[model samples]
Target chain A: MIDHFALSQAFGLLFASFEPWLWVVPGLLIGLIFGSIPGLQISMAMAVFLPVTFGMDFLQAMLFLTSIFTGGAYGGGVTAILMNIPGSSSSIATAFDGYPMARQGKHNEALGLGLAASVVGAFVGYVLLLLLINPLAALVLKVGPMEMVVVVLWGLTLIATLNDSSLSKGLLAGFFGLMLSQIGMSTTGVMRTSVGNPHLLDGISVVPAMIGIFAASELLRLRGSAYLVQDEAQRDIAFSRILRGVGETFRYPGVLVRGSLIGAVIGAIPGVGSSVANLVSYGEARRTSRTPEIFGKGAPEGVIAAESANSSSEGGSMTALLALGIPGGAATAVLLAAFSFHNIVGGPSFIRNQTEVVYSIILGNLGQVLLLAVIGLLMLRVLGMVVRVPLAYLVPSVLAMCAWGGYGITGTVAGPLTVAAFAALGWLMRRNDYPVAATVIGLLLGRMMEGELVRTLQISNGQPFNYLFERPMALALFVFMLMVLVGAPLLKALRRRKLQQAGR
Target chain B: MTTRFPATHAALLGVVLAISGFILWSAVSASTSLNNLVVVAPVAAVLGVLLPVILASALRKPAREDVGSGAWGDLLLLAGFSAFCLALTHVGFDVATFVFVWAGVVMSGGRGLWQPPLYAAVFTVVLVKGFGSLFPYPMLTLVF
Candidate 1:
């Protein structure tokens, strides 16, 4: 079952590619800076620098980008911990406990724990990519349209678990996002709601919309703030303490294992990213914890759970991308495009035909994880200094970057304008306490769901109920969805009743 | 105990429901071909929009006080800003961008007239001339 020759070749290629570590380090450093900075995403950084890799070998170019991805992901946690602001959407879950830990004067501990968890989680994900991705790819090859629909629905059900505020609110936001997605053309060769604009033919670009909603809105919110104070402090963190933090993470093996598994599963489902994985894992950890009340109050365990799951999604996500040629998240989508540009065909055949290349990628990812850990620890001392920069200066620079990045998406001013519009909408939604993730979920899943639903209907001759009922996987998914919708509330009620009875 | 729903929530929910109902009605009416508008559209439409609106109306009440102020002004400002940006595209990217940035800075609460003028000039000279040559095309197309 195992091909030793291919594996050896992969390792050889990986080792031989070390000369480009020169470019890799600088690229990672740049990615780290961008990731730590609010409004500058890894994609923007990669896109801006993609031209530099034009003359390099294909594998070298990929290694450089993957290094950036690995570094950027870890970099996002720096701002999240030191400042209240999350540097990226993936880091939002990190902020819940990480920021509180910082305010409580456990800044070094928080940073150490986050970095360690991120590196380990990424390693675990990379291992899965190496060992299981090929087999998974074989399975995915047999998936039909019906199976794809089930996968999409499974991904969408994640929104139910993302927002703890209210199910109705989250669902509503997701549905609204779906509706926004419908503003373009349908797969059926008909325009549903373009309102006669020729530009509407291609549908709204998710990147511009995401940039507008997350980055631009964040800038507007920071507009009137006085200078952002970078919190630079001289805290001596011992090597033993960092090791102990890593040890403490594994001490809660249940949490680590569960979080990793959740990340892997959620990562395999398209459109769901680290954000959803972090939320669900954190929620699950809270649900099962002996001291659930300690969550959101600088619990190191909480921080570990969230960060570990969040990073592990990267691993699970790559599995999906390489195996199915279906990207699990936006970053992976960019990676897919890069693969296409390199003339590397992804999918089930990738494992069989290009096993060496795939294994090389896996090995590269392992190297990236190790590099991120060492680099992150070294930068930890400086990040505390970086976070002290004033919000006033930071805000304008971020806004400018967002404006330029949005414009770069479509090479037009309209992209920036869309960013502004979405910013206003996001701000309003935040004010109303609606979950922004829900809207993004809707936007991401809307078109896929519609197309799948339409195709499923056509196959069954307008008999929707029969199709869902007849298909075993679809039926199971629907049942799973219902259970998820009801599970949280039921558990809460049961817990409350048990407490009431004990008191009486 | 007494329970009262807020008028704002009621109004918002009512609007959402109306919109969903209109879409559903349109879908049903527009179904000339069996494959065109099927049960999925209506089901998804009703489930996604109408259910949420109804749930929102049933579950929560709006606050008595108007929470968000300067609402009308903010909308007007946004509209005006968008219109101005669109208008700037015809004058070429450098000139338009300089004006756009300057105007944005001013509107964001910069006080001095000299600041806008100075920034505009600098942006034209540095950003327009310097950065413009670096990119592939003119920077001011309408993205939509």
Candidate 2:
């Protein structure tokens, strides 16, 4: 499956100039800073810096963006170890045992363990991507419009049902996003929901809406917070102890590998990315452990499980982006926008045609994983200070940047308006415990889903239901989606009910 | 169980349903073609059914206590952010940004007067100058 000639070309493309390598360290630093801060996300950092990438060539831009992706994975674990607060939702499980470790003065070891696991997870994730891309591309090449529609539905349903919230709320959020995406002129040239505005013709500007949803809303929620970290004493760092923790991670090779594997699989699914992967990995690590009693309180295994899975999920998410041109979550959504910015469409055709470019992007990530280890270790002390920045100062400055960046994108008032409107919508959804990420995934895929469904109907001559029997792949995917959306939950509920009955 | 009525939650759900209904109405009204309502119709129909069930479940459960210092505080900040976005075109980018940051610092609990404005001015100049050069279009600015 490996293309030897393309591999050589990818190597030459990446190493041809020092220019491509120039963006890696800076990208890592930017990601470290952004990911280390509580309430700030890697997606926000990617969105803000997206304008800067406009000047670079495609390879250089990918290097810059993926470096940030790599660095942010480890950067998030930093705050989770140092303070009780996780830098983002993906790091929530890291904070569970990591904070307990920190409270016991094992902060250095916790940081090290998380860092090492992240590096390994990222390495393994990209390695799997390198191995799987060609085959996955060939498989995706066989998919017709009917199969595409089923895949989209599978993604949306998985996103809606997999979250911590009630299924109704998640479905509502996803549905809301899908409906919002329909506000523009359709592919068939029919205007539906623009409400007489010309800007709505092209639909909602996805990037600005993303900034508002991921960045601005979080800033709004953080309005009254004094600092990201409450205590000053927790900011200390030691290099040697961290190295020791890094070395210790290899001792639990099984846990580390399992988490990475789990993360990669879940990360490939749309809407469910690192946030769920980390939790699932942590749960599995706990359930399968010899010493389950030590799982929650300052266990190095817990940190490794959470960090490895979260980091590996990045690679898994990239698989979907590279193979299907579908974003698995917010971060990949930004990457998708970047692909559009460069006028390159990502999917089976792109993967097949631009084999060298695809290989280069994957190879570049492997290098980024190594660089993240060095940069992450050296920068931990500096990054720890991010949590000390007053939220008051951070909030408005980022908001202004969002406004400026939005304007920079559309060159019209609609950009900033979408940012503001979506910011409010996102904040409200977050407040009500709705999954904003589900909404975002829905918005990103809605148009594509509709296009595919429309094509399927036209091809089937309006007997779309009858056509399903002919395409086994689509039928199988539809069944799988139903099983995931309904069967898994029903089984879980049944198990719980049985357990309760036994107790009675 | 003791339950408090969540007006905001109910109102937001209502708004979501209304928006979904409108989109569905628009799609049907725009064209009766299968393509128009192909995706939106089924999704909206499901959403229309699901939201009321959520609303009912929420009505039965106790409302979550506000996590922020107060909802009004966040709302005020959100209002300020909206004004800043709206004013970007009407007012110059520099003037609007400066006013927003300056007011934002004070409202977010900066104790002094000179410091907030100094911080705001410095922030506005750097952001405008840096971003102004980066963007292709000429931005309206009072102070460079």
- Best by TM-score, which number? 1
Looking at model 2 chain A, which ten-residue stretch has the lowest summed lDDT?
A155-164
Tens digits of per-residue lDDT for model 2, A393-492: 8678778878886787678888888888888888888788786666766776688788888889888998889999889878987887677557866887
* C-alpha lDDT (0 to 100) for residue A149 of candidate 1: 68
**Number of colliding residue pairs in each model:** 9, 0
| lDDT of model 2, residue B115 | 85
Candidate 1 chain A: 10-residue stretch with minimal lDDT: A226-235
**Model 1 misplaced stretches (Cα beyond 4 Å):** A1-9, A20-22, A33-59, A72-114, A145-151, A154-171, A227-256, A269-310, A320-357, A377-389, A459-504, B1-64, B67-138, B141-144
DockQ of 1: 0.18
RMSD of 1: 6.0
Q: After superposition, which runs of candidate 2 have C-alpha atoms over 4 Å from their true positions? A: A1-118, A129-134, A162-167, A231-365, A380-384, A479-504, B1-7, B54-69, B136-138
Best by lDDT: 2
lDDT comparing candidate 2 with the true structure? 0.79
With candidate 1 superimposed using the best TM-score fit, by how many Å does residue B101's alpha carbon deviate from the native?
6.1
Worst 10 residues of 2 chain B by lDDT: B1-10
